[model samples]
Target: MLSIMFYIAITAEAMTAALAAGRRNMDWFGVCLIACVTALGGGTTRDMFLAHYPLYWVANPYVLLLVCGAALLTVAIARLVDRLRWPFLLLDALGLVVFTIVGCNIGMEAGVHPIIVIVAGMVTGIVGGILRDVLCNDIPLVFQGELYATVSIVTGVVYYLGLLAGLPADIVVLIALAVGFPLRVAALVFKWEMPRFVFDREMRK
Candidate 1:
């Protein structure tokens, strides 16, 4: 189940990256590069933090191939993506749920503290988008104007609680997805966002 969800998550992330590349009018190579970064960056960050050797994609070379193929396919269908905006949003939400669950599971299995486990989940869910945005010279969505990272933290907490309650692994994953996906989609659809804190420079005096 984790394997399947991981594949789906990477594919969805690649497609989202592809769309971002399209928006920038990037060529095929740029598209592939962005897609790879967006698809793998989060998991890579998580693995490094955990001191897990031979990163996920490096261990499973096929996963890299899969992401590359998905990116190329997305480029082929680039013209229709704008028209399918809602589906793209839904896919991105699904990716967030899957990655958060996977990351939390890894942290828990590694015997990390609960807070660290949840933070791992958030890093897994948001770092990819942050890397993509940075590469594109845009502010990462997790940092502003959205409830993006908040949803990841929510998913992580839900998953951690499920573990504390001794729920089965599959049930825990289902609960996280059920709760997180809708919350993320709602935020996207309703333009929900965390209130930004603005600092007044004159106050420094």
Candidate 2:
């Protein structure tokens, strides 16, 4: 079940990223590149940090084809996708939580400390979006005072504790999704944002 959601989340991330590439007027190849980066960059980073050999996409090369295929399909149906903005936003939120859970699982498997596990989850959840925004020449959304990374952290904590409590793994996944997904949706719906520290003064020459 987790693997299935992972694939769906990857496809959704690629499609949304392809739309972002289109907004920047990137060519087809550029679109596919952005899609691949956005869909897989986070997991790649996590694996590298953990020194986990045979990165996920490298082990399953078909996933690259999956990302690129979804991207090109989005290109063909860009207008339809644009019209379904809310659905895509929900999918993106889902991707964040699912990716975080998967990363946390990997960290646990690597015998890392608990703190590192949560951080691993966070890196997986937000780094891909950060990379996408950077490539699109925008400030990364995770650094934009949104509730993004916080949601990932909260989800990871819940998932890890649930597992530590000896809950069934499947139930833990569902519980994490339940907690994280609605928190993100509420953040979006309510326009919730972290307070900013503004420093607008210019130094005298």
Candidate 3:
């Protein structure tokens, strides 16, 4: 079940990246590259931070192939996808939830502290989108006061607490996803945001 979720998450992420690439008028190679980065960047970063050997995509090359195929499909259906903006947002939200759960589990398996585990989840959930936005030359949504990163962190914390409460793994995963997906979608619909930092010019001096 977790493996299925992981595959869905990466495919959704790849599609999102491919759409962004198309928006930027990138070629097929560029689209595929961005898609892979968006799908795997977070996991790679999390693995590096944990000093885990053999990054996931490297260990399972099939994951890369999966992402590439998703990207290609996105390019082929780019117009249809563009017309279905809500579907993209929904898929992205789902991916965020899945990645958070996966990251949290990985951290726990690594025997990290609970707080660090939560942080690991947040990193894994958001870093891929961050890299995608950077490559696409847009301000990353997380930094723009969107609820994106907040949802990631909160989902991680919820999952962590669920484990501490001795919940079944599947139940914990479902609970985390249930909490995150609505929160993210509501935030998008309501334009919910954290207050942006504002530094006065004189403060800089």
Clashes of each: 0, 0, 0
Tens-digit lDDT string for candidate 3 (63-182): 999999999999999888778888778888988888988899889989999998998898899999999999999999899898988999999999999999999988988899889999
Which regions of candidate 2 are displaced past 4 Å?
203-205
For the record, the alpha-carbon RMSD of candidate 1 to the native fold, in angstroms, is 1.8
**lDDT order of candidates, top first:** 2, 3, 1
Tens digits of per-residue lDDT for model 2 on 1-118? 9888889999999999999999999999999999999999999999999998799999999999999999999999999999999999999999999999999999999999999999
Error at 128, model 1, angstroms: 0.2
What is the TM-score of candidate 3?
Answer: 0.94
- Tell me which residue pairs clash in candidate 2: none
Residue range with the least summed lDDT across 10 consecutive positions in model 1: 78-87
lDDT score of residue 22 within candidate 3: 91
TM-scores for all predictions: 0.93, 0.97, 0.94
Candidate 1 ranges with C-alpha deviation above 4 Å: 200-205
RMSD of each: 1.8, 1.5, 1.8
Model 2 C-alpha RMSD vs. true structure (Å) is: 1.5
Alpha carbon deviation, residue 187, candidate 3 (Å): 0.7
Q: How does each model score on lDDT?
A: 0.89, 0.95, 0.91
